[model samples]
Target: MPRFQYRAADANHRIVKGQIEALHETDLVTQLDRLGLTLVRASVVTKHKRAVKSLTQQELINFLFQMEMLMRAGVPILTALGDMRDTAASTEAQHLSAGLYERIQSGETLAAAMDKYPGIFSEVVVNLVSSGEVTGNLPEVLRELVRALKWQHEIAAQTKKMLMYPAFAMTVIGIVVVFMMMYVVPQLTTFLLSMEQGVPIQTRALIWVSDLFLKYWWALIALPPLLIAGVVALAQANPGVRHFLHFLVLRIPLFGEVLKKIILARLTDTFALMYGTGIPVLDGLGHCRKVSGNLVIQDAIGRVIERIASGTSISSSFAAERLFPVLVIRMLQVGESSGALDESLKNVSYFYTREINESIGKAQAMIQPIITVAMGLILGWIMFAVLSPIYDSLSKMKT
Candidate 1:
């Protein structure tokens, strides 16, 4: 592609000059003519380095919402995209819209035009749109897409809500611990030394721990990231390690169950959506695997696909894997027997979504008290160790 500078005149003969990307000046002139303008002067402009761009989640959601609304208004797909481009907040989306508009004007289908901007639209989205174009159901597909995005956004917000307080509390507790060890402990230890008498075992232990921490405080702060990086490298280097780590995550006490539910919800929702769009079961499972975000789940889904290929019933395949919950498998069984597998999967997604929300609530209620108590105990011990000797020495002097 080449960049071209063109001077054009509208029907009123008002001159306009702009740089546009095209194959050549001739193409630029052709585009200008399509825009109902005549090109007075055209020359190729130098191409510069192109920057890669991506839309944020919120932006994409807004775009989808607007598209759904416009589509419901009975506007043509290209016209809707053009209207969206005019109101777009980002230059990247504007460029994408322009390209998409050009493609549609050139007789390319709207879905095919969107396919050129995979960064802005996912394969699932493009395919669904293509299905809509084929089935003459663009409004319905866009409605479903908007619902899907809203569901995802809700899940993400819930996840953030679950984490935000714990993260803030942990940081506060860490700062308090560091302050007691580094600044408070050493000043109080002098009295214990001057007394030359037996100190409580717990106090001595606390003092020694504080001294060690003070001496190597920097190492304490850096250790977490170092350990995490080392573990990540090990996991990457060895498949067994990676698998073990994944298994370990699923076995974690408080969070593993929540994580499992969340992942399952995402998988079921995506699978349902794809299935609803007329994609085959096996193909839906394959696509779901790509978006599952868990390698273990991906492998399990692949196995499920293989089993389905071998003529096993959907529910039987799922039950054999034992990866999904019994509720989900039962739903699949019912769906398969009833010949409404897509609706059943949708119900499964809804079930897991409700479960995820309840689990998050329970976990949030349990975690705050646990964190507060544990941190309080640690800080109280440090305070006792640092204050006891001072009080003891003062009492002796008064006696």
Candidate 2:
């Protein structure tokens, strides 16, 4: 969609200027008319050139919290938005709030206005707000949103903590290996070759590797970033490649289990939140599919949706996919029979959350020792290769 900048006049003859996304000028005009404005001028704007920055999660959480408090205190929604816009600390927050205020003032529902900034407000947020709007429970929905956003932030932080150490260790190991192969090994091997004596096979192999590194060290330096970029680009452009990569990640021993737990926790939590908010199950599952972040899981959810549409019970639909654990399936069955599916999903979320935390701790414990041992073995190999020949030469001299 192309963005358009337009100057329009309200019914009271006040000029309004803003940017909106539309398929064409006609669409822009139609949208303006829908907002009760007469378009005076319109021009297509380049989206990339504008570089609109989105608000951070914390900023959005604060905005929601403030809005909830204000609304609870009987402040009007428009007034609350305007105050938030004026008092926002960051430019991104101010931009979002001001844009939202203008749109709301133009008679758009809060959800409809928020739908424009998909980067900041997710489908879940938009749908939940729309539901709240329909149910006359905007303040309560806003509070729930605040809690959900905070939980998401915390989960992200925990995941980072779980992965950071392994990433850092691997980076350090790569640097050390590069340094040895490029510089240290070359110097030592050159000295050994100058000795004019037969070298051991291990020493010869080390020298060959060192020479290769010295000859094409640039490739070593460049390949990692290029490979990473290529993989990311391919993942974004090709769904099959992305799905394969996600599948690979999910099969990666201890780490894979942790990642699965994290994803499951998030999925269940989202499903619970949506279902509890008066959204229908199929609609909630559709939203979950979009936000699942894993193609495999999304596909499974899609299958579940199809099954449910064919008149299968919710639990039976979920069980047909066989992607979920037995416990999850059983809980769903229980929830279905008891008319507390949302509560059951919430319990599933909590179960996965606890599992993720413990798995992360155990993984970190195991990984640290494994990394240490691997590093020790690499150093030991280099030392043995360098020293063994010297000892051999000493033995020859003694003989």
Candidate 3:
């Protein structure tokens, strides 16, 4: 699709200028007319180029929060959209509001219009809005959407924080090791070799490693990033490979359990939100399968869906997979028997969220001391290797 920059006059003869995507200029003009805008000028812009970037999570949250407030205050949806379009602080927000307003004016539903911008509005969001539209509960749904987005942002922030220290520690350790092998050890080893005494095994081994590193310094510097890029590209290109990588992450010690809990927390949180918004259980599960972010979980959800479709109970289907914890399975069973699955899912979400927080805190506390001990060992080896021969020389002089 080609994008077009256009200036037009609305039904009230107010001038509006924005960009929209269409098949051609004619189609762009038609879309403008449908928005009740009289096209004054239009020019096709290049594909894949936009004047504005995508909206950030915070920006989207603000937009939804404002929209909810306006609707709750008795303002019409179109009026609220138009006001937001004009007053938006960011170009991304302005463009989104304008596009959505025009689409709604052209007789498209809000959810349908939002579906056109998958980058900004995820499938989960669009489905929730569609349900809200159907039920005339758009304001309430939007509030819940804001809460969900905020919770997601917080979880992401915490996860990043949890990983930051270990990543930084490892990177610093790598740099120190490279510096020692390339510069420090070589200098010290030359002096040690100048002595009459034979070098100890530790010193000899250290020298061998230094020589290897100095000889292949370029490869040492380049291989890590290249390897990481290759792995990421391969994962993206192959579903099986990607799934395996996700599975591998979940099996890792200490960190893997935290990652699994995070995924489950997100899944249950989203499930509760969608189900609370009047989406069917099966439909909610289907949407969750797409957004699970873990192939293993997705496959598990897919199997659950199939089981439900084949007349199996939801709780039984979940338990049959054996991927989820016993607590989650029990909660689902209780929800199913009591006919309050949404509330049960909310409890599940809360449980996992609390677990993730505690697990992350403990992991962080444990990692710092572990990293310190590892660094101490490496430094100790280098010192002992470099100093042992010197000690031997002193003993010879005394003899």
Candidate 4:
């Protein structure tokens, strides 16, 4: 197929310049005329499909939200996309809308139009949209999608909230410790040595540590980050290592419990959305593996999927995994028994979301005070080590 660049005029004789694929200039004219525009001038653009930039999560969410709102207002899909293309603030958005508009205007379904830009839409999103198209409920599906994505965004923000302060406090504490060891402790040790007094054990230990810091300060600071990067790189390259890392991530005490809830909350919400859109439970579970974000969880879901495929109950399949909690299993049992899996999952999602928010709040509160006290203890030890020597010497002199 050949792509052509064309200049056309609509009914009002307004100029239209765009690219379309066709067999010849004759085909271009046919396409333009079909779109209610008469061709003025035409030239070939390209033969190959133009690659599009992958849209970010936020961009996809925004696009879906806009599309849902517009379509719900009775705007035709092509009209909405064309309007968006004309008024788009970014080249990415313009290109996206133009591509979709071209495809859709050329008789492709909206889901099929979106299929041309897989980088901008995930398989789950495409499938949901396809179901919507098939059921003639695209607007409702888009609305559900918007809600699920916003919920995911909120979950991500809450997770970051739990981590932000503790990370900042720890980094500050590390820098303070490094500064004291390299500058303050050494200066005090030198002063104490000049006084020609017997050094206390604490002071000697501090001086030794100061010497080590002075000699290997660069290694002390650089090694941690380097080691972390190496571990991450290695994990990425090796599936087993990546799996183990994810496993460890889910076992990290209170934080792990909170993270598990976050993952489950997202998983259940997405699953429920897909279910409500008329996608099969098995297919929905398959789509969910990608969103789990942890290899451990992904593999567990895979196992659950296999078990379900082998003629097991949904609740049994999930329970056999042993990774899902009592709450999830019990909810699944209820949903399965009552034939309301979507509703049960939604309830789980709601409960988990509330729990996640509360957990984040409690973790934030607990973490701040713990970090503050830990920092205080560290600084106190350094002060006691540096000052105790001077106090002992002064008392001996006075006696």
Number of the top lDDT candidate: 3
Candidate 3 local lDDT, 259-303, one digit each (tens): 989888888899899999889889999998999888998999999
lDDT of 2 at 295: 84
Residue 396 in model 2: lDDT: 82
Off by over 4 Å in 4: 1-50
TM-score of each: 0.86, 0.84, 0.86, 0.86
Count of residue pairs whose backbone atoms collide, per candidate = 0, 0, 0, 0
Write candidate 2's Cα lDDT for 49-98 as tens digits.
23337778888899889989999899999778767765678867766776
Model 3 accuracy (lDDT, Cα): 0.89
- CA lDDT for candidate 1: 0.82
Clashes of 1: 0
Write candidate 1's Cα lDDT for 217-258 as tens digits: 889989999999999999999999998898888777768888
lDDT-best of 3 and 4: 3
Off by over 4 Å in 2: 1-52, 194-197
lDDT of 4 by residue, 1-399 (tens): 457888899999999888876556765676577689999998877776456787767877888999999999999997798667656667687678878877886789988888778778878889999999999999999999998888888788778878888889988998998899988887777688887688888888888999999998889879989999999999989999999999899898669989988887888888999998899999999999997899988988999999999999998998898766797789989999999989998998888888888988888778878898999999999989888888988898999
Pick out the ten consecutive residues of candidate 1 with the lowest summed lDDT. Answer: 44-53
